[model samples]
Target: MTQAASSAADRRALLRLARQRLRARVRRPNAGDAITLALPAVLVAGALWSGSAASVPELATRGDAAALGMLLAAAVAFLSYGMLFRAADDPFLRRLGVESRAVYAERAARLLAAGLALVVVLAAYAARAGRIPDQLLPIALVAVLTAWGSGAAATTLAGRAMVTRSPGSGWGCLTVGMWDREVAAAAPLVYAPLIPLLSGGAAGAAAFGTGWPGVGVSLAVALVLARLGARWWEAAIPRFGPQLLEMAFAPPPPAGVGELSVGRGLARLLPRAAAAVWARDGVVTARRFAWATRIVWPVAIVTLALLARRGTDPGTRGWVALAALSVWMLQMVALVGLGRYERGGRRWLDRSLGITPLQRVLGRWAFGWGASLWLGVPLALAWGWWTDAGPGWPWVFVGAGTAAVGAIASVTAAGWR
Candidate 1:
């Protein structure tokens, strides 16, 4: 075939693959599945709306638009993580029987299109909120540009991480989370919408007053990082396919730990049976620690650092700090609860071993909480010191205690389900 014809054929194949994937994703879920996916969002939104009357005063007094912008950026970063890093698995690439920079260039083009769509939506919202045409246009343009840059930077960070760490490693999940959090904390304004909301001004003022040059610098950095990531990705692609296949085909590694006399040693501190159960659960918790620990603390620390450096209104600062602490605690609990469900299949075995449901639940809770404490102690100390809260020991105790109770409650609820 001629070069032009060959290229046309390849484009057709890619378009067809894209269509298939879209159809697969759009297939309707069952009623129950749809409800399961959506009920939490509904409930949370409903609760917020219901409480808005009561919350208005507090919210007005302590709201931080900048902080909210950072959170939105973090959410987008998470949403795009898979898109940015794992194009090797693209069905179109397999069909093409080719691996080249052109594939990624195509992917980047698609992302740009999507980013433009997002910019358009955001511009409409700004206009509706009374932004003049001049402000709206510049804001839209900046939002798209900044998003492109942020996404490229995220991709580069993931690629660099892939080069340094195996995804299957124990800390791999944590490392990825920390990177996301750090990026969000560091470049919160990249999302652009946050600027006007916080500034309560036209786009030009927000853009310049909040240091718009940073956005251009980020774009420059992203260009350099993209080059580096592409080089690393090219080297890594050859090994990627086999590694995935091996993982898919491999059997589960056996329950890899021996029964412990350690449980007996701790029996004096707890019920003998509970201690034994806790020890076994401890092994599992150690092996499959939650990704949340990696995420929450790093994000919280970075946020605190930002607050200290930027110096928000004291009321806003305190509220933000408390909110961060709450998030960290809630995340720890949710992770523990999820882990219990993950091991639900083993409940029968515990029953067979004469362990009551309550004991099994508590044991898992204990292990989760204990592991969280080990992680939280250092964080609490850091937070306390950062806050200049005298007698930081109270913060340490509060952190550990809150984590323990929350985790226990989560595990118990999961068991009941």
Candidate 2:
């Protein structure tokens, strides 16, 4: 790029930043934003404080730290969620006649500090009044972590916006405006999957019969996952919107049968799957929601693996894999819904314009199967390796077959009323 072009791009970015800040300051505040931003934190906090009061006493008498540990764990989760919940900077900040960045920065810091001080005072008094609760450690840790996440949400947004304005060749715009909504929407669901694991994780694992030892091993594995995941989330959060957008707008491969090479660095993407994976479905399957669904499988498989480690024999683990069909079935349904949006709702609208459903289900299964494995193959291999279950054996056959069947159900549902 020439010096003129580089200077123009920089100028555009700075102007855009300034314009956004101005708009945020001038925009009117509304009740909905306030409700949306604060409600989850309130509910989580209420659950942590009230639920712990009752459970902690019972567990305290028995010296069972698990109950308290669980409560604290929950408290921390709510706290973390609250922290990560990105509240839109009030557009009305400019109305207060203190709109410049320097002033805004100073004010934001002071407000955050004051809020923390007030919370600390209130919490200390509440604990004292409640007779000095026995298990506040977890609750406190979780709450602090949550606040940190919340505090960083804006910084994350700013960093993301900066990246957007300077997207190098082929990189697209990732404006704070567009992603601010998407991340805000998706953030709530992050805890949705985990909540099931927290409360029902044991029951799900017990389906394998490894007992607490199984659960322990599952957690040990999850911690490592959590660390890796945290690192990935930090990198992905900023550019995810633009990257996701590009994935959507980029033209898909032709329906050709030959001369395709995925060459991204995965054994599963070997010619066998790649050749069969049609470009259209391949791109659809390769997108965000599809990958998210694929990731969900590990969460499920890990729970089952814990059971296997505890006492779920290899055969029983296979059985658990079969039962996993239910989750796959449901997730494929989600994919179908996402697929509609991904395709810009053209197909659905066409159907509405009087296109009839063809009876034969020929490509439906293949589409779902290809897509499921498109996401699942790597996951299955990872599962096999992690559980020491002899790689390439079950993952290659049983896992693939099960995923295929589930995709069939999901695609089939697309045709139904």
Candidate 3:
């Protein structure tokens, strides 16, 4: 019991240290740094606001208004966190637990694991309990993107706070109510979004007892519940709090240490081994970590669903343009592939040739395009399904072909370099 108590005390001491470090990093910013961080957000908001101003559509009813309002709120919270995090550059949050080098490689891996779990849980919940929106496919898309955005907010805030922060002083956004510091950082825009979301939610809950008055009231209540629920989702910073979700599980065995020997048959695949090696890592480095890729098709699918539901006349040219751009963005992962390989390149290189700059460049393209095709094929199929263009496999084949074209174009251009 004495030993256990001592351990607990040590843990608390360590956490406090990390928290102090994070706070310090957030403090003491220079004027230039402050302005540089602030500018991009201002430009984004101005552009979006300007767009909204140009066409003030009547909020079809209370529900439309609620979602639109929440979107703005989500946007503000996201943007402010981004600005603050960028300025923070705090890495002090890491406490003196695990060795630093192992922690770095595992961070990405651990995040991916958590995200996969989160996605599976949320989908199961939605499938079982929630009344997904009528524009469900698109709604799913938006939800996916929103989840990614939520992550962006968390990382930016925690990462920037890194300078003064200990290695692991992560953010628990549910604790945001206490963070008047961050919430107040971008007041002009922040307030605009948050007020409507919060107050409207409070108002909606009061009306939930309205008892099936109409579809309108049902959705309004749902919005209110969502807003309240979101407020409670404070993530536990792994290193500081309970330490449940470390970026990695057990540290991977080091080079020349515990590698599994491949049998003779598996050795034949060696030529293609480099491609196989980086597949998952490459997709991950490409922002699939945020589940941003999942958002694209769901949005496209939802949009297509809505269009079909309304029986709207579709323009072929518009769709072709949309398809081309969608494929392009999906393929952007190729450019970022090198980053993942480089992160853990030492271990990979032991069994292979060392990565020359050119090989690194080529490998990145290969991984990016390979994963893009993985995503793009389905998106194209869904488009065909929705539009009734042809049978499913043909569209899938077409998408695969188009994505190949994009891969070649991307890798060939100086852009991938």
Candidate 4:
């Protein structure tokens, strides 16, 4: 085939793959998935619709515009990084004879397209809110350029972290000696463009009293980052591509001390059959990095409590904190409940064990409930004491009930699989 024909064919193949993946995701919606997806859309839609003509002028001020640009850039960086690093399609694509650079390009193109679409929506909203056309143009341009730059930087960082096998370096340490050291390092460089974008936006607001200066700065940053990421991707693929594949197919790492002890110690406190199942799930939690990272949720809950305390009356503050904690508990049903099953050979082992469905359900429920209380109890008490409210001990029962529901849902889902 001619070079041109080959290039066209590759484009068609990638597009087909993208379409199929999108279709599969669309077809597999469950109640939890629908709610999880809808909540974000609802929040964004609510924000957009809540503002009025009266608020538009103040909202379109330079500082607010700059903050908006920074916020968009930050969101793009985080989403792109997570999507690129956690994806498991590298090995599958490699097997299909897809070039690594082409795979990265395809993914980056999709992200850039999504970013541009978001820019258009925001710009339209600004125009509808009576912002001057001149101001809207520059703000839109800056947003598009910033998103492009942020996505490229994130992709490059994710790629580098994926290829890194040394546990002592970068975020490889997060692997905690389990699985491939695939966690992207929380490197500040991935977000370096935010500084320039923010500065440019502020400078544009000050100098031109418009967003024009930001457009040029954003474009330059985007071009440089894109070119650099492209070069690094091409060079790294030949050297580390095989290693990347090996990492994907690698067996689960040996259990650490925490995994062993946590399960066994918890088992001692439960009934015999349920204890066995609970111990197993507990070990699974330890092995999964998702659970460890969820520590952030509790931290966020505390931060919200502290922030609430500043302005509100003690009664209101206490209620607000309690409400936030309750929401967190409810969310745990989806986050922890659905993730109880093991994958691959271990899944087969689970089936082969002479454990009854009732025992499995009871065991998993106990595990989830225990996990919830372990995190939630301390948080509730701290909030109560700090706010001079009475002990929030009743939440323990509420947490247990929610956790049991999550456990049932998870086990039922696993059975279907």
Number of the top-ranking candidate, with lDDT as the measure: 4
- Give the CA lDDT, 0 to 100, for residue 43 in model 3: 56
Shift of residue 205 alpha carbon in model 2, Å = 22
lDDT (Cα, 0-100) at 289 in candidate 1: 41
- Candidate 3 lDDT over residue span 1-417, tens digit each: 464464455445544654575466458543222333344346544544444322432333556544543443343333433332221112433445432222221332232333333334333434444333333222222332333333333443343243334554534443444334433333332333344344433332333323234334434443443333222222213332223223213444346643333223333343444344345334344332333344355555554455355322456525543654564554453333223323343434523555343444444444444455554555555555555544445544454454444344433332222
Q: Clashing residue pairs, candidate 1?
A: none
lDDT of 1 by residue, 221-303 (tens): 54564455456555554554344344234233457543345455434576666777677655544334434455456555665
lDDT of each: 0.47, 0.40, 0.39, 0.58
Error of 4 at 341 (Å): 6.1
| TM-score for candidate 4 | 0.64
TM-score of 3: 0.36
Question: Which candidate wins on TM-score?
Answer: 4
Task: Tell how far residue 309 is off in model 2, in angstroms.
Answer: 9.1
| Sort by lDDT, top down from the best | 4, 1, 2, 3
Task: TM-score for candidate 2, please give it.
Answer: 0.33
TM-score of each: 0.48, 0.33, 0.36, 0.64
Candidate 2 Cα misplacement greater than 4 A, ranges? 1-248, 251-283, 287-334, 339-345, 348-366, 369-417
lDDT of 2 by residue, 282-360 (tens): 4555443444445455555564455446422676555545545545554554545433343443446435644333311
Off by over 4 Å in 1: 1-36, 43-69, 78-83, 86-145, 157-236, 240-277, 290-360, 372-417
Ranking by TM-score: 4, 1, 3, 2
